[model samples]
Target: MTMSVTPKKAIRVVVWGENRHEQINEVVRGIYPDGMHATIAGGITELLGDDVTVTTRVLDDPEHGMTEELLAETDVLLWWGHTAHEEVTDEVVDRIQKHVLEGMGIIVLHSGHHSKIFRRLMGTTCSLRWRNDGSDRELVWTVSPRHPIAEGVPQPLIIPGQEMYGELFDIPDPDELIFISSFTGGEVFRSGITYRRGYGKVFYFSPGDEVYPVYHHPGVQRVIANGVKWAYSERERESYLVTPMYLPGGFDRPVLGSPDGLVDYYTRELIEPRENAG
Candidate 1:
C-alpha cells in the first residue's frame, strides 16, 4: 500500500515592524503592547490558522531580523515602519531586494511605502500627502470586490479613527487597485494596491498607522491576513538568476552544436537559404 504525501509545506510569513513608536510613545505602546509586529503576526495566524506559520521580526534585531537564512525561509514578509526608515542599512535593503526578485512575496503596510525596499522595487519616490491629528475617520472602499485580498473584506472598511493618508500617491500604476479610501476631511487615497517584480508579488495596504489602534481593527486585520494569503508564491523556482531558454531554430538560425566543433547542418527543408544565396 502507498501512502499519499502532502503536496506543499505550510505558508511561511515574517511580520517586520520598526517597533520604535511602541518603545518611545506611551500611547502607541498602549495600543499595541506586544509591539505591532507581534500584533500583525497574531492577526495573520488567527485568520489563516493551521495553514500558515507566522513569525515576528523587528528593527532592533541583528541585521534588522532579516538574516539571509531568515529571508530564504520566509515565503511572505510584511513590513511596517514609521520613524526609522533611514536607519535601515543599505546592505539589508539590497538583501531584501535580491530575495524579492527571487520570488518571495512582500506586503508593505501603511508607512512602509516610504521604506527603502518598497521604494527600490517601485523605482519611484513612493511619496504621498498625509495628515494625522488622530481624529480622522477612514472608510476603505473595496474597489475590486472580486479580488482575493477583498474576499471577506467589508464594502467600506470603517475605522472610527485613523491617520489620514491622502493622494497624489507618487508611484507607478498598480497591476491591481484593490481598495480606495476616503477620510472625513474629504481626502481620498489609493489604500490598497498590488504589483509584480521579477518572480515576486507585492501588496501595499495603507491603514496600520502606528499612532492609532488601526492594527487592532478586525476589518483591518482581516484585510492584512487576506493580503498575506494572496501574496504567497506558488512557483517551483526561487532563485533570482534566470538563464536563457533554448527553442526550435528556423531561417538562418541553426540549432546549437558543440561550440568547439562549430558544426553546421544545412538543408532547404529545415532552414531556407538566404534569398541572396548564389
Candidate 2:
C-alpha cells in the first residue's frame, strides 16, 4: 500500500490582539514594544517566512481590525485579548465564526478563551480559575507530540514567572487534546486543545501572560507558527445543494423519469443558523 502526503500550502495568518496590556502594563510593554500581536507575528514571520504570510490586527482599529474582506483573506486567525473582549462587536465575532465554518483556521491564545467568538463557537461558558500573584510556573506538558501543532514543543516547558490560569475548562470535547499544563501549586489543566468546526480547525493555547514575556519563548513561538500551518485547510467544503431546473414547457415526461414527486423544485439541505455552521 502507498501512503499519501499533502503538498505544502502557503498559510495566511492574522494575529489579532487587544493591545491593552502593552499600554497598561510596563512589563508587557517591555516585552513587546510593538504589541503582543506584533511580537507573535514577528515570530511567525521569522519561523514560516515565505511559507506563511503573517499579519497583525488590533481591537482599536476600524471594523475592530477584522472586516469581512480581511476575514475572507485570512486562512488562519490568532486571537489574544485581555481587558477588552467585550469591546469586540458581536458582528465581527459572527463573521469570524462564519469564516471558521467555511474552513478558516483559528488559534485562540490565553485569555481569548473567553472571547466572544470562542464562546459562541464552543457554545460553552468558557470560564476558568486564575491567580494574579505571579507565582505560577507554567509547565506545559506535551501530549500530542506527533500533532503538527506540537511539532517543536518541548515537554513541560517552564515559564519561570507568570499569571496562573487554573481550570476546569468549560467546553465540549476537542478532536485532539494536545498540551496539558500542571502548575507548581498542584493545579492541572487542559492548556491546549484542537478541534474541527465545520470544515476548519480550531486550537486553544493558554500562554502569553499579560505580565510575562511568554511570546519571547522559542517553544511558544514555534507552537504558534506550527498551529497556523496546522489549522488551515486546503479546500473549502460546500454544503448547500442547488435545486434542479424545471423541465421545458409541457414536454412529455419520460416514462422512466416521471415527475411523480421524484424531482422537486427545491432540494432540502440542512440549514444551520449560520451558513457555515460547524
Give the Cα lDDT of each candidate.
0.87, 0.82
Q: What TM-scores do the predictions have?
A: 0.87, 0.82
lDDT of 2 by residue, 117-219 (tens): 9999899998988877877788899987888888868887787876777877888988899988888788888888988888788999998787788998999
Instruction: For model 2, give the 10-residue run with minimal summed lDDT.
Output: 253-262
* lDDT digits (tens) for residues 1-278 of candidate 1: 99998876789999999999998899889999999998999889998898799999899999999999999999999999988999999999999988889889999999999999999999999999999897899999999999999988888899998889999999999999999999989999999999999889999999988878888888999999899888898774355554322335645544323323322342213222344232
User: Which stretches in model 2 have alpha-carbon errors above 4 Å?
Assistant: 1-9, 237-278
Candidate that scores best on lDDT: 1
TM-score of structure candidate 1: 0.87
Error of 1 at 168 (Å): 0.3
Which candidate achieves the best TM-score against the true structure? 1
Candidate 1 regions exceeding 4 Å error are 1-8, 242-278
RMSD values, in order shown: 6.6, 8.3
